[model samples]
Target: MSSTATKTKPSTNPKKKKKQQQKSAAKKSSAGDATGDSKQKRLATDPPLECSKSDFDSLLVDASGLADYGEASSELIDCARYGEVDAVRAILDVWSPGKSKDGDLPLESGQPARIVDAADASGSTPLHKACANKHSSTARLLLSRGADAHALNDSGNTPLHWAASAGGSDCVGLLLDHADALHSLGRGGRLDVLLKNGFGRSALTEAFASGDTATVQHVLNHDSAEEDRLIGGLDRKDASEGEADEVAEGKSEGAGEKSDDEKGIVHEFDFLRCSEEGEAVDSNERPTVLIRELVSGMKSMRGNDCQGSSASRLYIHLSFSRNPQPIKHADDPFGQAPEDDTTGLGIWCASLVMARWLASPSMVERMAGRRVRELGAGCAIPSLAAAVHGSPAEVIATDLNPETVENIRHNVELNSSTSRAAKLSAATIDWGDESTYPPDPVDYVLCSDCIYQRDIVPLLRKVVSGVLAPGGTFLYVAPDGGRDGLPAFISSMGKNGFERAGGREAPEGYRSNPLRSGDGEDCFLHFHELASTRYVLYEFRKC
Candidate 1:
């Protein structure tokens, strides 16, 4: 009996204990399932990360059995592209200017909400698309709503660039006006007329390439107007101060003599006139004449008795007179003779470099049977070399100045027999007048030492675009004349669909020989230092 009492406390209830443990485990598992189901339900109710307008319209159609909006109900981009003003406004109203957790805004907000400057996959913003499609009202709206005018697309093109490429004169005008305002506020630098795209082209260049005469003229006019305003303002200010000083000083004994000297003083110094055959000439003493010999590659032609070999060279003679003569035509400022009649100052190193480059064997082969044209043919040396040595099918040397045109004609006639293989001619061509351009496209264009004036760059680009053929070549030579406009010129060329093929420094032997000093006894070679006004040759091909 005592042993049974001690064992009663250890009575086994294995089935009941196992059943209770099973119930507890089942409750825990049920709670986890409920929590997981709740999470799934919440996830199902959430909106999609990116919802286009089309998707929303589809959802509404499915819910209400309504007709679909089709292509019209796509997104903000579609609205802009299709010129849906009301739709764009509605979408922009609720759109917050920021990114969401999913990087892009959620589509549930009625049109995949986009910020004003938000770009699509192609990196084109609403402004870019609007201007590109020539939707002036849409572009105005976006610009008014603070869209970035300078925002770059995938091709590094601004909204203005697109406008220029599309030949939208109104859009170009609006963007340029906006740029002026930004520049005045010191927000942008000089309105960046020289700003380049991915293709290294400027807005001005694009306008010219598109063959939109109105747009091109508009751009040129804008630049010229800006320059005039700046120059006029400065001139006015200087005149005012000068008048005040003169009034204060009253009538002086030397006033008449002073007026004569002031009138004689040359305000603008032409660098090209300073160096004439290495001879030291006083600035006041006008040059009477200039002579230069441009030498390049070796030339040899078999003869009966002996082998004829001589350095390829062209002799250029230019005459000048010391008098300020009125231009023949008032409308043609470029056609006017220089004030002092010193039109042909010195042979630009660029001309010599271009002559040598075109005379190269490879370049000559390419020039075969090609019509060539040269702009600003100062001495016509390059054009002469191309015709005489390069063996082009035809060559036309053109100049804006009448004197230069006559000089080029003389040189062409002088070398006519030598350049018998190619048809050569000289003409007075004004770049400002489009009517003077040739009717047919030219196979090649040559420009050397012509981009000296900043205001003339746009006109030059226009002329090049008009005259050059689709697959033609443009050979440009520039001297480092302390002007920072070369970069802008090159950028403009690129915008006009001209791609840079190659560039090089002026070769040593190809440069113009230095003029003989006093008595023609002490001869010194006129060499341009690499650090100074060195010549640069550039080759570009039109695409």
Candidate 2:
């Protein structure tokens, strides 16, 4: 469709019309990042009976304060159901737009900005809530009517946050281009906003922790200039230890951070470095921290081989020791132990144990100690374990999370020298980077519980297809829960030539770890064979 065709009709209200045109262009610009043709086809052709109008009504009523009805206006629902642009336009005009009881205010009202201006229960404005429903036309209308892009809801969430979280990248890119909306703001301010959450969390930290590369990249890119400035200043800092104190204190207050460059980060793990005393060295760096990285990055914790250190190794050993008793539904083979009770041991150990179990047996029997790779290998405990035990000539563990990548290096070093752990290697690898994939086809690829985001399935499939050798085995473990779990994964895989190999039951010992949680209370890992079920066999392998 022509870009102009997607635009709303020029409003009689000139001010409103300008907003509409700007937003329309933004949406078009970001459309390229939307779910693409496959997602559109799925949304359009799937069972209409199952189609949801919540996103549409949420738009009409502004998506807040409508919990009482267990639903929103049916008129908007019908418009979405009918898929007629004119019908949708008509319904939006009649339906009350937003939480305002009097309906949309007249442009002449000149009303005071009240809590009502930001009266969203969630981080949705009428525009955001509409796009959430995938009602593109209604969204266009609301933007034309002058909905505020900067307004945040109870959760400090903007409409763009909702859209991006929903994988409505087009909507996100749209609002971003025209409005220059703030992405990382907390309820009260912009600095360290991404980390605060409803509880306190950096949204960037959450995205990284959840393995949402798209979300992370979006936030990081939103302020690349700032990132470069911080890096440049860091490069200029005195290398001597004596200057570390001054730089550290200055960094904590964000004194001299350089701007981020537009060339973009080659890997997600790249981050601003801190001074030796654990203080920020750059002005742009936020003081609030994400512990996952901190714990993983401490030098003392890293082993000699630059893989996970003895602390990490011991952490793994303790976590998987089956000690301190398991928790509720503990009898299940893959159930997790009480998190509080665990010494943070089970998950740490399970990652290593599982990695070795997946790769070693097959490596011995299959390709006689050839090259191997693990994608998104956090902490790389598994790859490191495989390096120690498996026959592969070389092993590389990669993750977009920089903290994890650093830990992988630390752990690899630890195991290489003092202990007979794996002679493992570490690198940062995003899903489909060809340079990261070895020139020679790999003998094995191992990943555990990596599928979290629903929209990234295509990218995951691309990575797998691109890296696998003609007969290279790809072993994956996914906890079978979430609104968008097995169904989306299985369907996408079938479309892409992956077949499920009827697998062995994941052991109970695997569940006592925290990091092992699958989709829900009863998630388990399945071994899907690349070729035949019988041909693949390692504890979690296909055969």
Candidate 3:
């Protein structure tokens, strides 16, 4: 009986020891869960790690437990910001197939590569960081991995905007090429070349503002061609629809066909021969005589106070052949006929508007005691007009071409009688050579259609900066001939200590004037020739 009682006691003791061990194991499990919850809370509320190499290194050490997608995503963005390609690859590989909760990428599903587009604290994706830093290879890699090129940050700037602002021309090219491919796939509106940022400026505008000529030109060239394609497509569709309607109504299609024939004839006719009466002649057979006379007036800015007291008209004559003759002198840039050599033939609409603006009494008052200089003074019309109608102390018309300079001299002589208040002079001045201009800073500098070439932009800016006096005015007229480098030219102006003072559109009549025979026939014709050309008058002041 005693042996049996001892055996039962031993069995009870073993059972009690087993129960104690089980309770201890449960306590340890609870402590482990509490620790995990605290770690998660700390991670959730913590500020984003600094985007630096060191911070990224530490993050990689603990990447194994990257199940918390928020923490992992933060680390990934930092890695991208620092251009850590290896670190980016590591993070991506870990989150690749089975490791994540649903056997998919933590941030984006299906496509693991799309994780590159995940936004950080500022709503900037890894692609944005890569672009802003000019990380072209990384950008290319991300793009190849399916990063969204059109993702906008908190500032409403896409990766393209950042690339343009950074002057990352290669990155810009990549993004633009990708966007073009997308457009070809019928995703037309996904990326906008004209997309404005928080500052109400497009990527092109930002590129221009930043003085990035390469990027600006790239965007302009691409956008212009794209716009042309869209417009052409629409025109063709409309023509087809019109033809269908004509067939359905049983109307004479002969009229439409005749109109098209006439249009073709008009296009083939030399610009000099197309008369206001719509007369068409064989341009190759004979040189069509083209003559334009512009009569422009300037009024007082005093409004009702001065009435028409200050209003005055200035006349300018322009003549050229519809088919320009070959230049006899090899050095002559503008191959004008020897007989009409004094007539500055390629008169831009910007020159007309600038002349008009200078003629305004208020504008004249501002130049009352100032020395004014006009660069690339084509035909010298603006200078002559300013001399004849405005009250500048002196006016110097300068051109790079010797023939153009001689023509300007002749024009000054022609208008000398009327230019009583101001002294007008013409000189052959090369903007690239600073010695040609006066040593003393000029009070006003006028520029029109001078920045057509990208290589000359820097030279032009240098000349303007060298010649302009402190607090002086620089009046510029840029005609929109799809000049890709214009924005960069303007941006360079700001960097050279110039600020926009004011701006205004050309006179309504001048803007709408058609070159047809009418009141102010030559002026109307000149305006009409440049009607599709947009002219912007910018008034900038040196600080």
Candidate 4:
């Protein structure tokens, strides 16, 4: 038989070629599968690969009923190891920790499981895992489901203690809140507690040691009763041996000549040292040197603008300057004060704002090279100083208070290099309103003493969020009045997808000198986030 020769035709589509390749590949897999030459044949592949769920069940059990307890319960270990919340919950519901089906043995072991303070072998429970990974929502779920917030791990650290030392104040706040509700009043009306860390310390101690004042204050300010309890035993001493000895000796030499006021101030300093935790510790631990330097500098600046062109002055001031002018509309938040009068240093908001910023230098450095606009730039001292020293050209100085505007001009002259002073100007700005010549979306919005009223924060937030670039920041420094302000701010930010970064302790060298006290107490007033009293350099960036 003769075959007729025919021309072969090639498929034009690329899909044809791919199909051929896949067919050949399929043949190879089939061959391997038949000879068991795949993963099973490759012993050198270490442990054999796990079977798929369907296959594993086929070999492991009869699906109609359940697997034996020993084998079935072991699945919980894998669930926990993989952090599978659903699987763990399922296992927990089926194998609930207490008594077994026979009413004799516990679900975990033959004996009954401890109820209130149970922990896993690794010294952790579901709560620890959630907190350790900063899974806040998961932690809340666990807490609501009856996970003990006070249960200690092998290290003896309750969730609160771990949260504090770990430096996430949100966690600390959560745990402290839980502790508050559960605490029982003792026979003598004292608050009973739980949740001690390995060091035998409460969450407050950890918060204080970490220098997270917001956390400390939140934990402390939960109640007047809790506040007294947390602060009760903590000794706040100021005079270490070296400083006290010198003060004592100096007093002896000036004994008769020293004014009674001077003696009282010194004595008060001693007492303050004993009361404030920041000062109670020894020289190596206490913030004394920095405090002394600030106090000394404030003494010399007496009536002059402390934040003027001097390098040292720039280093100290942190807020926008308050100026005096027609910018002071009836709507101005800072009450009216006379313009062109430099003598009224007694209640200058600008000066107080500057003093607060001096509490943390690192925080000031972080704002460098960003578009910063001050809502109420009193004296414009801080803004001018920032423009000259750190971030320049991008600072918009504004004041709604007229006296602050005039003072701002004076301060600009006081601090600026003549060339830079010419470049800086103070203007009037009303927050929460659109500006005609709004500068490039502001990278940072700075405000000081703006939280006197609770309602003002929403306004501030609206202005900040609206004016800021996508990742812009807000640096706010307010002394105690907005008691629950930070939480509200955080909640608002969260709705906008912003979270709190760690805050820093205010610098120790800062002192409220202009607001003098005839008494010797070291006036260590603190600014707080929420209800916490901490001297902080807070930073909040846009989501």
By TM-score, the best candidate is: 3
lDDT value for candidate 4?
Answer: 0.41
| Residue pair clashes in candidate 3 | 515-524, 515-525
For model 3, the run of ten residues with the poorest summed lDDT: 8-17
| Model 1: residue 131 alpha-carbon error in angstroms | 70
Candidate 3 error regions (>4 Å): 1-345, 512-527
How high is the lDDT of residue 163 in model 3?
A: 82
What tens digits encode model 1's per-residue C-alpha lDDT throughout 427-482?
Answer: 86667788999999999999886765576678888888888999888999886444
**Candidate 3 residue lDDT tens string, 282-339:** 3444211111221111111111112211101000111111212233332332234322
Residue-level lDDT tens digits of model 4 in 210-287: 555454444443332132232222212233444333442334322334332222112112111221223332332312
Winner on TM-score (1 vs 4): 1
TM-score of each: 0.37, 0.32, 0.39, 0.33
Greater-TM-score candidate between 2 and 3: 3
Query: If the candidates were sorted by their TM-score against the true structure, best first, what order would they fall in?
Result: 3, 1, 4, 2
- The model with the greater TM-score, 2 or 4, is 4
State the local distance difference test value for candidate 2.
Answer: 0.38
